[model samples]
Target: MSDLLERLRGRGWRLTSQRRVVAEVLDGDHVHLTADEVHSRAVERLPEISRATVYNTLGELVCLGEVLEVATDGRAKRYDPNAHRPHQHLVCSGCGAIRDVHPQGDPLAGLPQGERFGFVLSGAEITYRGLCPECADRG
Candidate 1:
């Protein structure tokens, strides 16, 4: 996702070496990495990268709308880069694995007009939980 990094650069972001490392760690399809997990990976690349820096960079990325925070349940939040696409998440209840899934229709349509409470809703997030193939087979 050099494109994302380049966009951030064009926006006049600091683009510190630590920020660049975190961005590269999150650069992928269907990658839902938690802040701790991200820090862990970043530490491998640059041992001096502090947790605070990672958290700050992630918050900045989210503010820029380049990253989506996927909180699948009440656990650790995962960072998603598929912000340009409209899709939902399929989470594994057993292993905590996450996948990007495009459902059949508009999920927001399920909210009937009567339940709207007189407010215009623009978007919706739906989380589907189930056992992944590997987890299911283990049982």
Candidate 2:
């Protein structure tokens, strides 16, 4: 069983065949796949699986806080299974490839009280953009 599957099971989420396949497809590091990408992979394992099922399962996962929806560079949203972990993203500006980055310190700490406009902060998201080695090599 993958970490995602384990977590879902722990949360008492039903593990149907379609949902299992979708979860398996998302079980990996730096895995940031769009819904279509996930459906493509799920279809390989479960040919009977429909795109709608994949989409619905992804939506449920996101709502359950089991997956993170990432919209980078105005491109299609990607589903990340590293929700339980604390990390941000490092996106390759050239290819749009994403990697998980665990930077030091609290990101919200840098925000000055005056700049906050008096709203309480719960969390923050920071995306660092640069070229990956493959993209840099191509450049």
Best by TM-score: 2
> For model 2, which pairs clash?
none
Model 2: per-residue Cα lDDT over 18-122, one tens digit each: 999999999999999999999999999999999999999999999999999999879999999999888999999998899999999999998999999988999
Model 1: per-residue Cα lDDT over 44-83, one tens digit each? 9999999999999999899999888888668899998777
Model 2 weakest 10-residue run by lDDT = 1-10
Off by over 4 Å in 1: 1-3
lDDT of 2: 0.94
Q: Candidate 2 vs. truth: CA RMSD?
A: 1.3
Off by over 4 Å in 2: none
The TM-score values for the models, in the order shown, are 0.89, 0.96
